[model samples]
Target: MIGVDGQAMNRFQQKIELRDGEALFQVGGSVRDRLLGRTPADVDGVLLTPDPEGAGGRLTQAGLAPVVGRNGGRAWRGRGIDLTVWPREPGQPVEEALRHEALQRDFTLNALYSRWGIEEVIDPLGGQADLRRGIVRATGAGALVRDPVRVLRLARLASGLDFQVDPATLAWARAVDPGLAAGERVGREVLAWLTQSAAPGKGLDLWADSGAIRAIPEVAALQGVAQRADYHPEGDVWIHTGQVLDRAAQLGQGLERGALGVLMLSALFHDVGKAITTRWELGRWRAHGHEAVSRDLTQSRLKGWGLGNRVVGWTVRLVADHGRPMALARDGASLTGWWRLLDGHPCPELLFLLAQADSQGRVAAGEGEPSPPLFTAGMPFRAALDRWGQIPMLSGGHLLAAGVRPGPAVGRGLTLLRRAAFLGRWREGEPIAPLLRQAGLLAGRAKG
Candidate 1:
């Protein structure tokens, strides 16, 4: 058994003994973590013995706190420590306590805990063994039945921990009663799973196997659909997705949980429409306009899942332009083509990363080589692509504000400006109004 660290154990033991008369209650995972030789970030405790006098008065008598409940049991100190104290014992044993906590929990792993002083983990339903075995198991018959939110947790743990699900657990999670989980609960849990899992591909597979995928049928359909053998021998659309999901999950650590959350959703949904557009021609499967379909389907799924507007908007942008980066990498893509792809887009680099991961996964499946849009071999093309970020010009909105007539001219002028910038005809910081004027576009005049 790994004993507690120096001074910490002594201090906590002293604190417990000093408060002998008062029942002690701690409300976090620090104890379990400490026993496991892991440094926890939160250490929260409560005085189980009631304070007839008051919260402050009782703490003062124990020489602990004059008013610990001021923050409503939430206080964070140095070293990323967050503490929360409960008012009473929620259940009889640690197992029941876990169930009480599970009422608010979304997954089985998060519900697993141990007694405050006990060395062994109080899995009660064998969560620790499951963790060691790399599988996720539900608590009991009521695990998913009591809270449908747990389904998202299952996905999250599968990815985050790289675990498989027990067949029975998978079956139960699949049969989860809909409408039992609130929209916010579903959104938050799914977002968390997407953002935190270490093997998101596994999570997606679990979701698919459990019927949760059908809840968002558009994404579900991506599985097992054939890809062109010439380009994608990765087995099918599902296998391609799994590769991307695995890569994405490896990126979870220290990531911006919010942005990463959206990125995961983007990655999962990016190829979703390929199934619908799939067609066989000359013994090769082709998915024409799949990118467009994927964007539409992704946005629809995000909205259906009740995701935040910001997440939905970012996801839409990623999905819509996910294929644009390939254009930048492809043969025959001129400076003009590159500029058009980057115009007004904020995340060109991230799009490239996504495209790269997608290409790599595809290549691993013996898909010959990534299709056009990914640079292959051409000195002139390479030079032009390299210079893409250096060029810039005025936007349509700028021309409109300059009194340039709003019409085809706006689009035409913007295109000309971008092209000229790429060709060195328009220098940086040059006023575009004159250029428009040279093109016979009058300021503030709407052309017929």
Candidate 2:
């Protein structure tokens, strides 16, 4: 069932010019995936041969712009294949060199290798056996500590490759400092786990077990935070958050790239504020103004990751308004309130999707999916959107034409006009009135 490339690999083997003792082996995910009956999108190879020009000189001469890492090894990334080559000892036997390279991989499953143009796999650490056993075992005792990124990588592989981590390896992973790895690398690993994994919640549970929680203390703080049993019969804030992420992964399959990234990040941080804002009141717990705090915390976290302003801005707004859809639909709000929800918004659909996921996350044990109204397409959130979208476009430009001076008053006047027009209380061309005086206009305002 291994679908390793044949003719193309044979051509590569002929071009690399292997000497008697030298070898070029396709290694890591490519070989492992091929054995698992999946066509790996990316192929990794290690050439146990040296050239006077450099480790990747053969490939570069064969048309690649390889980069040399700090370790003096060269990595050439091109098309679907990424190859790394390091200088090997003169007259070193291929078996010994391949065994040494295999021992250096982070996990035994990744330690598997296959020679170019050869069908047989050279498993130096019995990675093939571990692969069949569906286990991810460290190649060395110090592997996790040596590269703490492996802890997060385990988060990905847990669901990505559908395998379990060896208990001993998990123990070692839990002791390593996640900060030892680059933050950007950490972010990418986490994003992949949440976005690509079918069970992002379980992957994060593994992450927390591996001490990757040290990477984001905000999330770790959620572990024991309380929620009212009536509304959140499932469990604590952390458990609720996990459920939300898994629901979001299903809900977000329709989204892609920055949009999906925003949804996932919003879902992760949507309830973070509950850790600080939850209070005992009226005989139960309440997070009266958690969304605002969550919005702030989410902004800080996203900025710390050096995310772009557009993604950060949208995610922050979504976090801020996470409770709006259901609340507004049930109790209603000012036209300006709902307008502000979607104002300058790139995608309200994503916001609603995250909100739905948040709502779906909390449930009693053994209960089915939450009922619709909040979950449906004709959701009150949508009605409000339609109403707001139809607001008379008597914009700031129109007011300027009417000779109204530019300032806060002009904006306020416009909002009032829109609010009045939104409820059909005042016509678009009618004289503006005090919307605050209207009976329906002052029901309530959104919390900060």
Candidate 3:
């Protein structure tokens, strides 16, 4: 069934060919998406005719709301399709409009267009050839250098398309000044591009190799700094980070933008501190206390990068608490230990995922044997978490309800009770009565 917009696009295309004696050329991502088998929300059309301005009246007569601003183009929200017009080569028709758009767009692969309801795919810039070859070549070196944002775009296209950038383009991107990219713009684009990747590590490597990684100094510094092979077969903290990013991006597929944003930033900066704290142990290297160091460093970097407080706060929490999972994996750590460590943390699951990714990286790097089975070997790790999820037999809120006065004792009693409960020394269904009695938290329940 042709929907209203599809029908409108059909009608509009035919009328333009008849009245203006010109063909409307669709450009940009709309064309790229169509070739990629995706439906786009809007289409950009370049009109080839003597009086491109008069085409607006005809579109308005066709019952479209024309938005006038930017690009010297009018936006027509009509017949179920939102369309924009870029006038090129007035007094020409059809092919000229297509040619004009191909000349102006940034990348060769993004310049191809499809004729509405026709089987014809236009490729003036060898865009289709680049798409077929899995190559991202710039339309021209001049156009690419005009906007430094293309450097980021080139990175995104290479990752998103899983294509190799042309060597010339890669060379150009590596030498561009960071000042050409506004930090806020880079930040926003990085956050957005992170969503389109299946493996952000590959993307990060591309960024590093292209010098985009150096644009953010703190992250770039992590490269090649070693972590102990006993703990990290993944070679160094930087190498492990790339693997973690790949894992995170894989898991984050289909997640919301906000969730993906958090995950990506967390993956990228999760181990940024290892560059500073690495030291040689008895025989191998170890990054003792790097988790704490990373948390502090990430906070400062995120602030400098102008990231939101919510993102920075959660990422810091994830980085700080990342080591807890390895501790949990150890059979000796008591529930009280786990509970104490996680007492104020947010999003324990995200932390665990990072830990697992870290472990996976180690194993992949031949640092350790594959992790034990999730049921038996992995059970203790999970069981401790499951136990932690249960509320303590008593809390400050519960103590206050039990007639325990609101004082430091109430707070103190809750902590002690929770500690005992976490250790399994406190039984379930037991009220704050016995705990209050023992701690002198209540009059009859305590002695004093």
C-alpha TM-score for every candidate: 0.69, 0.80, 0.75
Descending-TM-score candidate ranking: 2, 3, 1
Q: Residue 3 CA error for candidate 3 (Å)?
A: 13
Residue lDDT tens for model 1, 1-448: 1133435534554543534234433333454345435665555443333332344433434344433433344232322223223333433453454455444433455445543444444444554566567777776767777767667667665766566887888888888854466666666767766665566676677677776655556777877799876666567888888777666555445657677776778788888889889998777788889989999988876787788798898888888887765555655666667677766666655555566557655644334644423323234433655566666645778778777778988888887777787777888766677777778876554431
What TM-score would you give candidate 3 relative to the actual structure? 0.75
Better of 1 and 2 by TM-score: 2
Which residue runs does candidate 2 get wrong by more than 4 Å? 1-22, 56-58, 61-63, 66-73, 116-119, 334-336, 367-378, 385-448
Better of 2 and 3 by lDDT: 2
lDDT of 2 by residue, 226-293 (tens): 88887777799998888888888888887777788888888888988988999999989999899889
Off by over 4 Å in 3: 1-26, 38-89, 92-94, 115-120, 251-256, 281-283, 304-306, 363-378, 392-401, 404-429, 436-448
lDDT of 2 at 315: 88
- Clashing pairs in model 2, backbone N/Cα/C closer than 3 A: none
Candidate 3: give the clashing pairs: 49-91, 437-445
Rank candidates by lDDT, best first.
2, 3, 1
Lowest summed lDDT window (length 10), candidate 2: 439-448
Q: What global local distance difference test value does model 2 have?
A: 0.75
